[model samples]
Target: MSKVKLFSYWRSSCSYRVRIALNLKAIPHEYVTINLVKDGGEQKKDHFLKINPFGFIPSLEVNGDNNQKSIIFESLAIIDYLENINPEPSLYPKDLIDRANAIAITESINSGIQPLQNLFVLAEIENLGGNKDQWAKQLITKKFKSLENIMTKTAGKYCIGDTITIADVFLVPQVYNAYRYGVDMSQYPTIERVNKLLEEHEAFKAAHPSVQPDAPKQ
Candidate 1:
């Protein structure tokens, strides 16, 4: 491989998922910080749009011989790509059934809960003349309560059976967004507990938004 590069937006939850996975796999990759919030997302530019027609952040570029390449968009896909590169110390279980279940777990809430509360979705909700803050808080609380129920079935030191699977990576960022919008985490003690433990892990620590170069001049 020539080099690995990840184009990312720090505050984006999807980017956070890829960051955690790359760190866990001990991959060396340069971070290209894209400005997601500045002037309607530089990601939408024609240059970048070609990279990902969807024009979303968190695109992973795997450079290899002859400029031959692989590109992965979507946080979960990038994580799976990282796993394929370094399978030792596997984040995924070997049993096919176990792996299937694991993928199911991550996809469940990642699709279920996150979309309804995204930045763009939230803005749309606000534009509809509803109380955005109140609606966000309400929906988040309900979704988390649902998540708490599902998580209790298989949470240990992590979200799924003691391993720091992709689910955990997905969970932490979602909760972080919850807190950002003033949702009281007190209602979800289990989620809070997991995040506290995960935050100390090297991957999560390195991936934290505060540590990102583009996070605000301080």
Candidate 2:
């Protein structure tokens, strides 16, 4: 296999999802850790910028037919790319409608909720004299409840169904962040259950921040 390298920071939910997908697909890859906080972050380094100009973590590369191919940037894109290649475990439902619904929920969190609550966004809110704590609560609760409503219709044992899918990939990490910031999960049982189940899975266990290649020395 050609070299498949992942540039990521362990704590990043986006990075976590890509790592979980890679493991679940049984793909071997070299993980290059990016310290998002150290030395002004490896992501900002000139050498890394050539790989991912956006200065974001979790940019995946693999040798392609022509050259080194950049597969995905954001966490959501990375999971989608995995579904495209290793359809076996079937992270996305194969049927058209089911697939669309599956993708919709995944996108729901990836785009609808996550973007508004990331560190950068939260920090920006704080800088603007916005009530950072309340802003977090407001955005997170609204989205969490919205996702719970959506999950009521779409979820099985996992996010999309009894089977694990790309939805789980988004759900697990986002919930982790939510919890870190004290987002009350008891109000959303389905989401709570899904996260509980994913935690027991080996792929997610292995891909956790502490075990990541570039996790801080502390």
Candidate 3:
């Protein structure tokens, strides 16, 4: 097994998703905190930029073969790499169609929803003299409405049937963002239920933002 190190911020939804994937796969890793909001965002610093040119959280550093290091940025790419290397207890379905469905659901959150309401995007909205909260409310509500309908069909004990897949990894973190932005989850019963169910899982619980090592001392 290679050494794994995760560069993450405690409250980043992307970071949270990767954390759950690592814990769910029982991959041993070291957590290196990158305080996203501290010192005008540590992620923008040269040190972290060297690791991720995009200066994003949740960059996974893998060390193998004479301790040669390879870094993967972007949440889905990191999760895919992890799944490829650690195939036991797979997070993706073996069937081709089911795998596509899983990736579809994952992308709906990872790309369709997250980018519009990302911290950087929100900041840009504010700078443009737009109301950030209202923007988030509108975008998240619209996207989650689509997600809820998708989940209604795909979910069974977990997203895309009874087995936990990459879809669930993406789901839980976005749900956290939903509540944070005060999106009315009451309308999305299936999504709400799945998020609640996944939260109870040991791995998901361990990866929650509040419990992270770098979480605010509250």
Candidate 4:
């Protein structure tokens, strides 16, 4: 079996999600840092563009036994691929309703919120003379409120039940982003609680942005 290669930025939330999944599944992979902030974004380079036409971070390169290599882009899609290939530490519930619920929660954060405040979007906002911090704060706060309400019914030690799921993978990164932009976490008790609990997990700790190989020195 050839090694898996993960292209990621240290502080990117999407990248963080994939790291958590990889760690949880105990899949060993090479970590390649694509500094999104350096040199007008290294992700836009030709080589990276070939891997992912969209030039996004967290493009996963999977090498097969036959030596063939394939790349997967998009955080959720890459995570789903990992889950499919590795079923042991299952990240989804067996029941149909529960599985769908987990996906719903994951999408709410991955699609509904994360995109709006991504680096590119924030950069665009700043280029247009908008206050990027204020923009992120408002958007994250609004989405977190909705997330808090949904989590009230869905959580149990972790989001969607006792065991961790893809929802938890999706949640922690967004919660980190919320706090980074100064969005008060106190308003979302369930999210805060779940995040606090999940933070103690080894996989979560291993995947934290601060500890990544490419994380900037403080």
Candidate 5:
């Protein structure tokens, strides 16, 4: 069995996605918390940058059977790796078109919505005297509106169908962020419904930010 270590921040949507994937695949891993805000963000520090040059959370370090070490960054790439290694209870659809639709949903959130409102981007907005909350709310609301339309057509019980796909993995965290940013989820009933069902799922519950080791005590 490969030894896996995950360097993650509790509240990062990217990290959250990977956590759900790991739990869903029942992959054993050591969780190392990287406080993104403490001491000016641990992810930007030299030691962590060595693991992931991009200074991103959810860096996966894998020591293979032959004792070769490999590091993977980026939530989508890490999840893809997990899916490749553990094929059962797959996080993607079996049908070709369904799979494509699932991937499309993942990309929509990964590239289209997430990047615009990440910590660094929001901090930069504040640096320029912009209201970070308002910026995030507007962007999330707009993208979520589009996602709701897509979900209306594709969803059955989860994001892409009754089976939970990579789309659900990506969707849950973004919806959490939407709630945090006050996006008024009622406008996106399909999204809200899917999110509600996912939140009750064991894998999703285990991966939720509030339950993470690094989350603030309440």
Candidate 6:
């Protein structure tokens, strides 16, 4: 087995997704907390930037056989690598059409919703005299409406079918962000219903932001 280390922040949605994937795969790893907000964002510092030029949270360092080291950035890429290495208890569906649907849901949240309300983007909005909170809430609500529609058709016990897949992996964190921005989840019944079930699952519960080592004590 490879030695894995995850560079993460407690409340980062992207980081949260990777954590769930690791837990679901039962991959042993070291968690290194990089406080995203402290000291003007630790992820932006030179040392961390050296690890990931994008200065993003959820960087995965894998030390495989022969001591060769590789770093992976971006939540989806990290999850895909983990899925590839640990194919059992797969995070993707076997059916090609089902897999495509799962990927569609994942990318919808990854590229469509997440980036719009990211910290940097919200900060930029604030600097432009825009209401960041309102902006985030509106954007999340709009996207979630679409997600609800998609999930309504594809969902079973999980995002694609009875089995958990990449769709559920992406859904959980984005829904977390939706709650953070005060987006009313009731309107998206399908999303809210599936997220409720995922939240209770052991792997998802273990990877929640509030339970992370770096989470602020309440």
Question: What are the lDDT figures for the candidates, one per model?
Answer: 0.80, 0.82, 0.91, 0.92, 0.92, 0.92
Give per-residue lDDT, candidate 5, residue 165: 95
Count residue pairs with overlapping backbones in model 4: 0
Encode model 3's per-residue lDDT on 180-209: one tens digit a residue: 999999989999888899999999999999
Off by over 4 Å in 2: 67-71, 216-218
lDDT of 1 by residue, 1-218 (tens): 45588989889888888888888888889998888888888898888887777887799888655787767788777887787778855777666765676676677668877787777888898899878777777887888887777677767888777778777878888888888889889887788888889999988899988788878866
Clash count of each predicted structure: 0, 0, 0, 0, 0, 0
Cα lDDT for residue 206, model 2?
94
TM-score of each: 0.91, 0.91, 0.96, 0.96, 0.96, 0.96
- Those runs of model 1 whose alpha carbons end farther than 4 Å from true positions after fitting are 64-66, 95-101
Which has the better TM-score: candidate 1, or candidate 3? 3
Worst 10 residues of 5 by lDDT: 62-71
Higher-TM-score candidate of 3 and 6: 6
lDDT by residue for model 6 (1-218), tens: 86699999989999999999999999999999999899899998999888878887889999766888878889989998999899879998989999999999999999999999999999999999999999999999998888889989999988998999988998999999999999999999889889999999999999999999999899
Between candidates 4 and 6, the one scoring higher on TM-score is 6
**Where is the poorest 10-residue window by lDDT in model 1?**
93-102
Per-residue lDDT of 153 in model 4: 90
Clashing pairs in 2: none
lDDT at position 173, candidate 5:
95
How well does candidate 6 score on lDDT at residue 127?
A: 99
The deviation in Å at residue 96 for candidate 5 is 0.7
RMSD (CA, Å), candidate 2 to true, equals 1.9
So what's the TM-score on candidate 3?
0.96
Q: Weakest 10 consecutive residues, lDDT, candidate 2? A: 63-72
- Candidate 2 structure quality by residue, lDDT tens digits, 144-194: 888899899988888877888888877888888788778889999989998
lDDT of 4 by residue, 19-45 (tens): 999999998899999989888999999
TM-score of 1: 0.91
lDDT, candidate 6, at 60: 94
